[model samples]
Target: MTVTRTLALLLALIAAAAFAPIGPARAQSEGPLRIEITEGVIEPMPFAIAPFIAADSSAEDYTGRITRVIANDLASTGLFREIGRDAHIGRVTSLDAPIQYADWRAINAQALIAGRASVSGGRITLGFRLFDVVSGQQMGQGLEFAGDVDDWRRMAHKIADEVYSRITGEEGYFDTRIVFVAETGPAENRTKRIAIMDQDGANLSYLTDGSALVFAPRFSPTGRRILFTSYDSGFPRIVLLDITTMRRQIIGEQEGTMTFAPRFSPDGDTVVYSLSVGGTTDLYSLDLTNGQRRQLTNAPSIATAPSFSPDGRRIVFESDRSGSSQLYIMPAGGGEAERISFGQGRYGTPVWSPRGDLIAFTKQHEGRFHIGVMRVDGSEERLLTASFLDEGPTWAPNGRVIMFTRQNAGGDPALYSVDISGRNLRRVPTETAASDPAWSPSLP
Candidate 1:
């Protein structure tokens, strides 16, 4: 099967049903311990991941690698704490071995994970189970995944997605990708190229070279194309890149005007972007099926960075119509925009959340730049990170986390991610500096 097909199977296995409560079976006589995500988390919930049982001697190396991946996925969320490998007291020797709940409880583990892996017929088959040691019961249905032996890392991620979804009562985003601008060189002369990588900073690849200056690379809904601004022709042009063909088409480039900062509509049939003409920048949409253009914003002030709501009914964008950069919402076609941001800052790069409930943005206030989010209607505003320069907020596939560029004074740009709850702030491991990351929807 193709990579996309395999991803479809993974999502089907993990997300076909709505989120159930994260605990033991509801019919249990005794109450089960659970983690409330909204509650103040003083510490991460403790869990243990045992070495996966190798169904064959040929799978022994893979068993340990896959087990560590599951442990890292849970630990990185800042919700589950993995007890050190040295703390292990029990192991699984068979695919159907009984979990030693007493051993897990003795080590203060609230939850335990066990699995078995096998290599056969040029394929790898994996089976995993989750247990609630506190309640001494299985957490959910056991799962099995089969795939090519070379795709062991992807299988590990698929398993991790299942474990995360069952324990967090939320959709899993592990099987996703991020496109960004990879940077190198000094602060004064930084060179950037369009780059792609897995959510965990693995499988890194540069899609473009440093010959052109690129910014704000947004993925299409199908994740097959990318829209970004490139300054290769002495003026910025919005370029559409087909990943499979490695071909580029500059969208709506006229002789006199410069077009930049392009983004796709929810359905991916059209693009909305900024076109600077005669000292005025306005928002415009280009029909990809036909070379048709419609101006969405004809304001005197600069209007740019337009993002569509999930349903395509509305668009949120940044403009300086009110004498300061702020966020506004309007109809997808064209209409009066209602101001959504009225905070003590200059806001830019407003991105509507994939969940459609919140809008993430970059705010500059009190001599500091912060990544912040607010309700779609611009209420309940909360800032997630602060740095000398924090901008271009992009939501994770599940809308639970935001990734953006963070640069300090006289420093180069790099990529960082923060949870929507204002926790788990960490830098994405990149060999070079990175910025303007756009997360792809869950694959397949």
Candidate 2:
């Protein structure tokens, strides 16, 4: 099957699974169900997690540390409530020992997690299990992992993933990283380069020399290559750089044209970008393997900020062919275009949702910029944020939230995220002023 077809099928399956009618057998099964999220409103599942036990002196010191990591991971998701250590009526010290189910239930914990840690020859081993507090039954067989002692974070994230999957029936995004363009200086003379860090903003490292102007860095689905635009020669050109080797080359380096706003296909083998030949801009796709190029749109008006749907069969982009810049959808190989936005203000930068349910964009009206989202059909449009110059709406891995660049009243830019419900607005701190943020897909 074609890459676009496969993606479309996979997205369709995921959507079916997400929005399918629930059978009576799975509708929160009444009392003592232990752990489950009923409806979209997450009723935080109460979980009792005691400090892991240790098999030796070295393991003893790491027990509390590692378990704390696990607890924090679960708590941060806002779906699992951790019983305070003081309220832990039961203290579990080993995975092999019995768990006091009544004690956990007495503390109002619906679930319990127990683990044991061991360290020898600089390697760490973790064994853990999840249990039903009320029924006093093990939910799943225990899991074991071995790794270097320094990889405790990974171990914690893996445990969180297992717990999340067991309870929520959805994948966890805790094990992901975000690569974005870090910015500083003034907007006209912005100093920007590619930098990556943990999804929560840690371990930041720059990938470029920071001497040229770069914009819109996007990670390949596999995160092996970065596709972005650069003005190193005083004219914008599409560039692809290897994340691991730091080697770079100009892609779609056509003569007398400016190319920008690039993104990788869902399969990570092709790049779709906007190229301006003369004064008219259009969308083009370039095959990474053989340098083949195909024009996807031909219009007199500007057609920039092209994004492929998860299945890659269609492209969502911003174009002014209808007078003002608005969102449009077209076949990936080029065909009749359908307008998806008819809102009052001008819209640009239409990005397909990771889950393929909606398209996010930047809207300008009343001298203010706002980040908004709408169904692919252009219905149910909702604005998530408004500011002096808020633009560049990027979706979280799960499509439950959006992160965008926000310029304060004074034009100081920073990264901020708001839940799709327009709640939980929080500023993501970076080392410097940042904008043009692009979030990566969920990590493996």
Per-model clash counts, in order, read: 0, 2
lDDT (Cα) of model 1: 0.84
The residue ranges of model 1 lying beyond 4 angstroms of the native Cα positions read: 1-8, 11-33
Error of 2 at 409 (Å): 1.7
With a 3 Å backbone cut-off (N, CA, C), the pairs that clash in candidate 2 are 7-311, 8-311
What tens-digit string does per-residue lDDT give for candidate 2 at 230-262? 998889988898878988999888888998999
lDDT of 1 by residue, 1-444 (tens): 122343466656444422122222332112364555672554788988888989899899799889887888778888889997799887766646667789889999988888888888777878777788988877666667776777677778877877677677666777778999999887677789999988888889888899988889999998889999999998999899998688988888988899998999989998999999999999999999998999999988899999999999899999999999999999999789999999998999999999899999999999999999999989999998999999999988788889999998988788898889999988888889889999998766
TM-score of each: 0.92, 0.85
